[model samples]
Target: MFKKRSLWISILVVTLIIACSTSSSSVPKLRDKHHQPFSSESIWNMPIGADAQYSGAGLGQAKRFSPEINYYIVTQETDPQVPWYFPQNWGVGRCELGGRQLGKIHVRADLIVPDATENKTPNNAAAFLAPDGETLIQLNPLTRCEKGGPVFGHPTPREENIYGMGITGGQGGSGLSSIGGTIRLGELLPSAPPIPHVLKLLVYAHQYLYREPPGYRWPAVRSDAYAYKDDSPLRYGGSNPKLVMGALLAIPPEMREDDLGLQTLPGKKLFHALQDYGGYIVDDTAWDNYAIALESGAETEFELTYGYSFGKNSGPFYEDINQLFRALSIVDNNTPETLGGGGTPRQPLAPPIGN
Candidate 1:
């Protein structure tokens, strides 16, 4: 009867929803140079409402960004010329991050390791999607003396499932993924589309170390508790009370690139994406620089193809990056419930989730 039909309709609708949620790109996402981390519904991929609540303290005004450096992102597929390994188990060495103990883990898939030259950065962090396509494997202090052999690094305390909420990951004092929010390979090229997801940010968590009142927010497991080195000052510790680890820094949806007077194409692209998707505070620079993490070789490709360098203080990236940071307002109300806020989204929901 009519009731039966209605019930069937409801069941059908539910099935469709599940299908949408589980359908992943059939193409091997990681083998390619494209793909962003996390699932369709991931907070990193969601756009905030135009009216999302924010704090009045702008990052630029606070001088929170360190203009000196932009961190690089190392990923599984970064260097195809180099060999890759699928180790049976990941090694742990007093590993700890994002308030979780990397020392304890029960992962089932092979740990994806790269044989490329070990990244020279101190963080030496690298992330790759496990073969299962469900787990995001992170390697901090990833190392390999020989280019084609055994791999070594600590597995994260809490490995994120891309199909799930993806609220947390394996690295950072903030419990964020070294790869999540990192600017993907071609995102900044002149021919590329506007960035489509939240970017990872590193603040100058320096000697003047301070965090938000409660330390961190959802998605972030904790904050930078390392108040200061064993020397110097900072007996009376405190928080910024304005910014936190998990907080999103975004352009109010109502604002346009024109409002910020962004002139460079690169800046305009970054501006639009940042306004729509915002960015996450993933780590601390420990120095005087605010940085956005980028995929390996991303900078090199950009320089060779785009004909500019971030090193130049007068370049478009330097100008726009500084300008955008200054205009950013903390998405203070961003939380599990209000992640995208209440206003209309700038982009469609990310592609449906699935392995």
Candidate 2:
């Protein structure tokens, strides 16, 4: 009798498990807002920072924002010049006056080519070779704002640019690669949340610190694993979208969970800042660690309002966010090597030395 009862209970439990998985499989697509079967490649399956390491060995000093956190202030400035790869009017609507917030970032712009109608050579036509030497990826008509088609999922090849749901801005793990500027207190009436909403991302042209992009192959890197003359990683600095994505994935899931992670007041606030407010990635190398964009008279406004509330470190914001991420292992974007296990990074084995 006892054996029969156990057998029946086991069968019922298996049935319930199958039912639950089948029912919750459909997720809404951002493009049509219609429910679609979750594909094997969905971004949901990909880990955060699915691209590259979060921290690099060459970024130099780390800033401690709290007792438990330390960060690299990658870039902070007002009115910096945009990178050459970015499209004109890239942030026209997205980074407009009222839209400064987290996940807000700049991106590489489409190149303008010479129209056959005109006699002269096109201004900024550049050649981009694919990872396979034989295929040349066309950059003449590369798009900054053009919406992409549905992304099958994350871990999409760097070669095929298509990302999730076809929405250009939201799906690409590229956006999460870097953080951007937002309204500061006493600077043109701050926004409601006081910062841009989380997940909005941006990237401007700059250099990366490493000589070689460690994680994976890049379009411009040579067969010898060195950068081409026109795209030397060392001379131009560096930015690896993959590295940033990988770092995001390394963040503890518990940190995101209200019930399991982040229970303390500061921990909760910091988690919200990272998960919602957003954090910056050292996508490209720059003169100073922080590079904030200034246009639309923002630079002048910041200068004029200096004595007021918006000066550095005066607002409620924490200057160095990398500190909050210290709970995870420090990922060295500059190093191609991996530790802890395969491509996946494991929890830090020991407390940070010299802490």
Candidate 3:
């Protein structure tokens, strides 16, 4: 009888051990490899590419078909010189309406001057003048300025398409540029927008341009129109107008991948802007960097299908832009315990496969 009892006890012990092992194994262990939580300071200070490795000044030109129009990224210093009639300033600074400070604005110039200048004989010029006689410049200022604080001139009713603010996390719709959230600029910074995704794209293109060892050259002018332009003023109109504008920063290829939660087609389109246009802006500063970062954050929601669906690894992306600033200290330690803590407990295991 004792021997029988011993056998039964052995069986029970084995079963208990197995149960414990199985339970432990079933527990989910969340792992995030892309962006291990780091203190905000560390991430913010994280070296963005090699430092002054990429630094310069002056307006970078973009080619255009129109002779009167000119496209370029003007640095902050040079921005003031741009004609008042110009649509907008592409670099940093507060936008003023009628001499009052409106909200902060980012100007992306599409048409610098219109083709109508070609037909002008100096006699019909009076017809083109506004009631005030200011020559109507075709340049359209796609301004992204603040609302409510200091009511700037109402954006033209048709200019309301706020699309392409870059990685605004699904807040905007159908070509609208108004980002849903506001990100403060300056030392005491608020959360960043989803603009960095665009920056990432620009960075990627910059990398591509100088990929080879020094001395290797890629075609400086790819478009045929600009390549064959003659000195004649009329032929100047045929110049590749596209060269006049490039992104202030390009998006990195890796950023477009599913990991960052921006795999959708729209996300891809935004990413293209980043890749193509990154760093085209003349001025490079902390404020611009921060703006880019915040813009990227705002765009995240948009990329995720109005925040309903997200890429599998997008949690970190969200955290990087949204919570990183607040959780800076935690990120330094590079552990969940240091950051926001680990994920919640997993659900209890279901009954065996068949029950």
Distance (Å) between predicted and true CA of 351, model 3? Answer: 62
Instruction: Give lDDT for model 2.
Output: 0.27
At residue 229, give the lDDT of candidate 3. 32
lDDT of 2 by residue, 1-355 (tens): 9999999999999999989878777543232111111122322211233333444222322222211000111122231223223222222221122321222212223222222222221111112322332222222212222222110111112222222211111112132211112222222322222222222211212333223434223211211222224464324334444333223223333454334344333334434434332333322221223222121233345446433221243332333333344443333342223321225422112111120
Q: Write one digit per residue (lDDT tens) for candidate 1, span 1-355.
A: 9999999999999999878767754443332223665666678788877558876434542233332122223233333323333333223321222232223222223333233333214444666555455666665545444434344454557766656556665445577776667777678888887787888776655422243244677778877555433452422133456566776888776678778777678778878887888888777665545677776567677678767764345655677777887777788777777676656777876765432
Off by over 4 Å in 3: 1-248, 251-267, 276-279, 282-289, 292-355
Candidate 3 residue lDDT tens string, 1-355: 9999999999999999999999999975441211111122121112222111111111122111010111122223222222232222223322444433423332233312212223231100000112222112111222224431221122212221111111111111011112211211211112322322112111111211221212111111121122123452222121212212121222332343344445344344334333322322111111111112222223344344344322223343333322211111100111212211112211111111110
Off by over 4 Å in 2: 1-41, 44-209, 213-249, 252-282, 290-316, 320-322, 325-355
How does model 3 fare in lDDT?
Answer: 0.24
Note the Cα lDDT for every prediction shown. Answer: 0.60, 0.27, 0.24
Give per-model TM-scores.
0.70, 0.30, 0.20
* Model 2 quality (TM-score): 0.30
TM match of model 1 to true structure: 0.70
Prediction-by-prediction clash tally: 2, 52, 77
Poorly placed runs, candidate 1 (over 4 Å): 1-34, 61-120, 207-214, 228-239, 353-355
lDDT of residue 113 for candidate 1: 28
Ranking the candidates on lDDT from highest down gives: 1, 2, 3
